[model samples]
Target: MTALAVGCPYPPCTVPTRDLQPIRHSELRMDTHHRGRVLTLRRIAPVVKLTARSWTVTQESSSGGTERLEVILHRSNHGQDILESESMFMVKEPYYTLSDQGDPTLRIDHPSDLVVCTGSLGNDISCPSSGEPGGAVAATAFAAPVTNTAKECKDEGNAALKQRALPRALAKYTNGLQLVAKDTAANGSIACDLHRNRAYVNLLLNRLDEAKADGTASLTGIKDQEHQDLDAKAYFRTGHAAYNLGDFQEAKSLFEEQQRLAPSDRDAIAYLRKTEVRLHEQATGEYDFRKIRAGLSKTAPRADAASFDRNTEVKKSPGRGHGLFATRDMDVGEIVLCEKAFCVVWGHEDEALTVMTYDVRDDMIRGFPAGLCKAIVQKVLNNPSQIEKVMDLYGDYQGIGKHLIMRDSGPVIDTFKVHDIVARNAFGPGPVYSGGPRAEEDVRNASTGLWIRASYLNHSCVSNSKKEYVGDLMVLRAARPIGAGEEITHSYNESGDYDARTAALKTTWGFACTCALCLAEKADGTALRTKRRALELEADAWAEVEHAAKAKRISIVKARCLARSINDTYEDVRYNGLPRTALLRIRKWLTEATTRDLAGC
Candidate 1:
């Protein structure tokens, strides 16, 4: 039999001297000295038993020593190498062995204990009979070391805390503290951050005490300017809580602290001021909230009017109910309801005429009635209470200088009632003195008076009411049977086309018009376009004939036909680029012809 060479690849004292033994079918066992420790082989198994050809061993010791060994084993058949053996072992220090049924098991007797081993060897040696061909043994084994119990608890607690389980996080933090017996930086930092976030959430839910407690917790282990800033923010939140609870004084104090901390912060300053004002009002007993309620009650319009019978029903549009309806059958001249003007502003020019300091020498110009104007002006000046509110609401008049006739630092003019009514009712042809060619010759005047209920009428191209001024009062007569709920409308501008009317409505009233006249006019655009084109052609023909007449070249009969065409085309040519003077001359001629034509009959 060939003598088997059994030697450890590890250093001197690490060699194995034991019989071959198997811990399992494919596993081998070994123990050796590594570094200064007598380390034991726990177990070894070949990943592929038939394929392995060479073996390697590595060892580590308790005293921080390491050893590496490689051994080549071979099998031969008829002087030829059939299979080269392979093995590998990882050995820890303080090696030891156990035996069961002639199979030796290798392991570390004490994993954490200290041990010593030999460092150097001089030569290789043959294996002893008691030693295994592929195994190892160590001199002795040491005892196992102890571990801290609290670390496990801390780890479990931390895992729960990371999942945002607040209760679990607190428990973990407590467990970690119990193990370490003092605050740790990692655990303390996490706890502080978590508490701060929790405090904010609690504040949102209006749990004031809870929020304050959490905020206090957040301050633990936090220091310096950041802590003070956070404290200021917390005080601001506390102020908000106090404010919501109607504790103005407390709120003010907190907000004042916030302002001191952040002087430039607008929100803090505003809250502080507001709370101070409220507290001052409370202290002085100056906040008469009941007076405000009474004033609002007095200003509210009466819902029940005596004029309309409650039992009567008026027809209205399909979806909309009746707004205002006639309670009784009324004559044409009957008054509806008298209402004072809600507000009024004198025309810029009229105000200028009244406040003038200069003397008027021109007889053709009419001066304002000084007595009435003065009384109105004095009323405006003397009524400080009225003027104060008005000035505050609308701001000061920048155009006052432009309209001033006299600079009395006294009261403003108050003659709004008559003038305002007149303005509402006044409607006529275009302004005669527009700054065009005929501006010097044209004289424009607005009808002045105490305009009746007709003044409140709305506008429409197709109107049911006819308005006429009698001395100083405006008279309105229904031209058709106006239904009870129908609005009393008037034509403000007779010359306005559909688009012009719609535009005026939108500008003045802030709504798109759905009036019958607007609907009809919009429907007529296609037909109106054709008619306008024909009118343009007729106007052009008339212009040529008028040119001939101006040169005194056209015959009398031809001139008459052309004059007729001019009258028919008046609407089409009125707004054209014709010089105002020339247009007026042509208008005068047309008037004369029409007058003659009427006289001949």
Candidate 2:
């Protein structure tokens, strides 16, 4: 085989003759016109610089005579000096042959093809029977030949999957699977890829069970690393399905398995832990689903719990619809509803109710409930395996014991959940209230509670109904007449300023302030700013009078006049009803003034 180099104006200036090898017979036969083209040429001797437009090739003919070949050329767009001739010569022999017959007019057109030629003259050259590159031939050889009609279907399916058409991807995968059920090598990869994609689609549609099954199938026949990943995904999807179905134990187990397979998967770990906590709560009877149902059912009559029929009614907002409404006019002190919380999450503080000491029939005092109490105490002390799972889910119960101590010292509790709802509307400790004659009253009211149904009472800066706790029951008594269709609201904060209240509602509850009182408060704020200046002047004047009286310089008449002026300003500015702390300070100052004698001073 022989090889030669041809120069072109493009980069990598010299191209090899016959691509430095022989062209395949099949490839050559397919394009016969391109065969034997002088695709490349090399210099036989060092030559002087020649202009691109005019060049000469010197060759020794068979007769031993030196022949000079001149070719007229023109510059091409690609900067190549092209020959304008009907014939050209071989680089070595200089024998003229057909070169310009189909020579490309544009230099850039298929310049690569023009640069390299393949023929038997080049070393390591061979004619390919198949008209493809070696690697493509190898891949084709590895693939099994289609023996059945199903093979064509499978191929079509694969094409669809590659196109990212999910329905078609699934159809192809199923058809492919049906064609070769036991063949792991030929159809397995295609089937698995299709199933994986289907699982992704199912997940997007929130079909957890279908997603889990598809994920499982996708993992089949996969290698070690890929198999483990597929298994983790399968288990994770299974966990989610179980969680939505309220099978917390099953969900926890599946999630734990997923976490074991992929320890760095934070979402799996977090969700697994949450499921474990829920399971533990269920086992301990800490979460009462029945109570939640009862609460929601009882509140069904109130407008707060009304159900909207989506088929007939056009909803103005996503979750807005009339369901619960008053059936009849009810007076003050009437029973609106009686309901228990869906779930009561007793924070760690409720441990005080564990009954540590027992009053025995004998004179000696022993642990309460001897058996049950001991078990409860032991569970707390030893930290049960179930509790470990809960801890794994929510972290170790840090503030639980502290709450227990506070509960013993008369702390409060709060709880929430709704009935008829697939999931709890809320979940947390119930609120409690403590008050007594003694400054340090160490008696807790465990039975005094607020239920989840009470949560339906919307928030208000000034509420018409007052919430009163009477031993595990919350009574909502009307402080004023409630009109029909008006949302029942309660005060979330007893001591919050207008700004603080607005911020809390917006941040925590995701709502804008549209309440009547809120509007009035906004308007009052502007007026208050002006009144504040006058009130400050009056206060300053009273302070001066007080100082002069203490120094025995001002008369009692003048001091009284200043004090009266301050009081008048207080009433006008609404500071007369200031909080207890400010009121006490003013009273102390007034008492001192009355005690001192300023006769003629």
Candidate 3:
């Protein structure tokens, strides 16, 4: 827990999906006479300042769908358990600013960005120019290739791959692929070629399944003649990787198809024969490819959970407890983090189980299907310690803002805690619908689940990030360019007048609003209270208006209604468009930001 040895000096072969919590280092627990240097880090404004020594940083992409913007210190330690370390704190992209930083020993930028200026290679930092920190020049395997602007990126990627600079190659290939998405050329040939080139790079990186997937992507829109050549190579590379992965049947099919296309590819024929043999062995239970399959590739759109942006980490802020912060420069639309949902329960039912209360026997947990209720409740019933873990989350659900007089049975507590966690941190189970806004009825009808790590992000009315549920994953994309060391924040309430948002935050999640918009609107007062109390106040106001109307006090009724309408126009100004407007805005902003960052515009 004290010191974490940076484990990957040589880089890892595969990038595993990281958990947001502490990474396990039990396997790294070692008793050694030679101890690696310990690099202790300290935090300043938004940068994790290196107080120990001036260390060089590097940017490299891994086939595991992660890009390591910085490296860790390697150490030899005597321990027998996983080394619990804090989230990595550092900022990565837009390192161009460091080009003039004039410190050779100190680096505020990644080495890859200084390749043209810093003509050196190794672990140490170096800079031959003013304000430029340099260590190892990025891989330049092949001399730069001259090609049309559309093909320029892929050609650069090819050179990086020859240099064995897998990460840099990926970035270039990805850049090319992005351009292809926007291109409207004949038969989409350029896009196919990009996929085919990326597939080859992935194959070299040992990402077999991703290579196969990319290979398949290359086959789309193949009416163009240029793609015909790419198609054969794509299939051949995919088959070769699949063969190594023990996916013999798939390998066989791909290899056979490749040979048919090339007609004279002896390598494809040989691989096809080997695949047939492996398939026969598999059919007879002579081999188990599970272990190999597990390491094949990560095609999912997330970095490892333990993986943080070079400048991202856990820090404590007063009032809100622990939250995420940037230690370095991050571009708008950067992926700060991605987490898998710890629990993904949707349409769960609890109709038969209700908590007893005064005036009412119990509150019906309706809208949830009966089958889902049993399944979820059973999961809790089977797990004895579920409540304690669930309680570790923000369980400020003062259910009805009243004391729960229900019996202390474990299942009942499970229901209460689960309800609290869901209310505070859970997002939807649908794509886009998960974290995006929803109608009150649509929310009740949809499924919801919790992603534990993402729960640490605090609320901001004028948030800089977009938190969305994309399929089973919770993604956090930067909405605006974030400076290093700045806090990462997202909106938890709607774009509306302060009072209504405050009430929702206070009544539902049990929190007060202090974000910029809230403070600007002078949102003061504890809006937290019973849900029914909120309804009661609204009802009382309407009742008074109704009474005045009946008594012929038309002026009073009109004044009250007009005041209410005028006070609630903030929402109309922000989101009066169709529901899809929010979705479109998110897409446009994110796409533009990403393109700018990658293309270095």
| lDDT tens digits by residue: candidate 3, 1-601 | 1111111112111111110111111211222111221111111112222211123332221111222122211100111000111112212111211212342222222111111211112121212221222111122221132233448777877898889876567657776776666666734666677788888877766555567778888885454555556677888988887665545677888898888777787887777776775565434323223332333222322211221234467678678887888766768866666554555544322212222112111222222222222223333433333334445566543332222222212123333334445556755544333233334323333555566567767888777788654444565778889987788888777644456677777654557887555654552234422332344345345444443323333434433444344333334343332121112222332333312212111
Q: Which ten residues in a row have the lowest lDDT in candidate 1?
A: 118-127
What do the candidate models score in CA lDDT, each in turn?
0.36, 0.38, 0.44
Ranking according to lDDT, highest score first: 3, 2, 1
Model 1 ranges with Cα > 4 A deviation: 1-455, 483-486, 506-512, 533-601
Best by lDDT: 3
lDDT of 1 by residue, 1-601 (tens): 1111111112122222232231221223254333432233221222211111222223332222223222112111112221112121223232333322233333222111211111111111111211332223321122121232345545554575557544334434443434444435345545554455545544554444555555556554344667667666766666765664346777888788777776777889888877875675544423333332233211231111111122122334343222233434435544333222212112212211221112121111222222222222232332322333222111112222212121111223222222222222323312211112223211221212222223335555666555542111233455555656565555665433446556655432324565554554455565663454455455445644554324332333444554454344334333343221113334444443423223210
**What is the per-residue lDDT of model 2 for residues 577-596, given as tens digits with 9 covering 90 to 100?**
23321123334455565456
| Displacement of the residue 77 alpha carbon in candidate 2, Å | 79
- For model 1, the local distance difference test gives 0.36
List CA RMSD, all candidates.
39.3, 30.5, 25.5
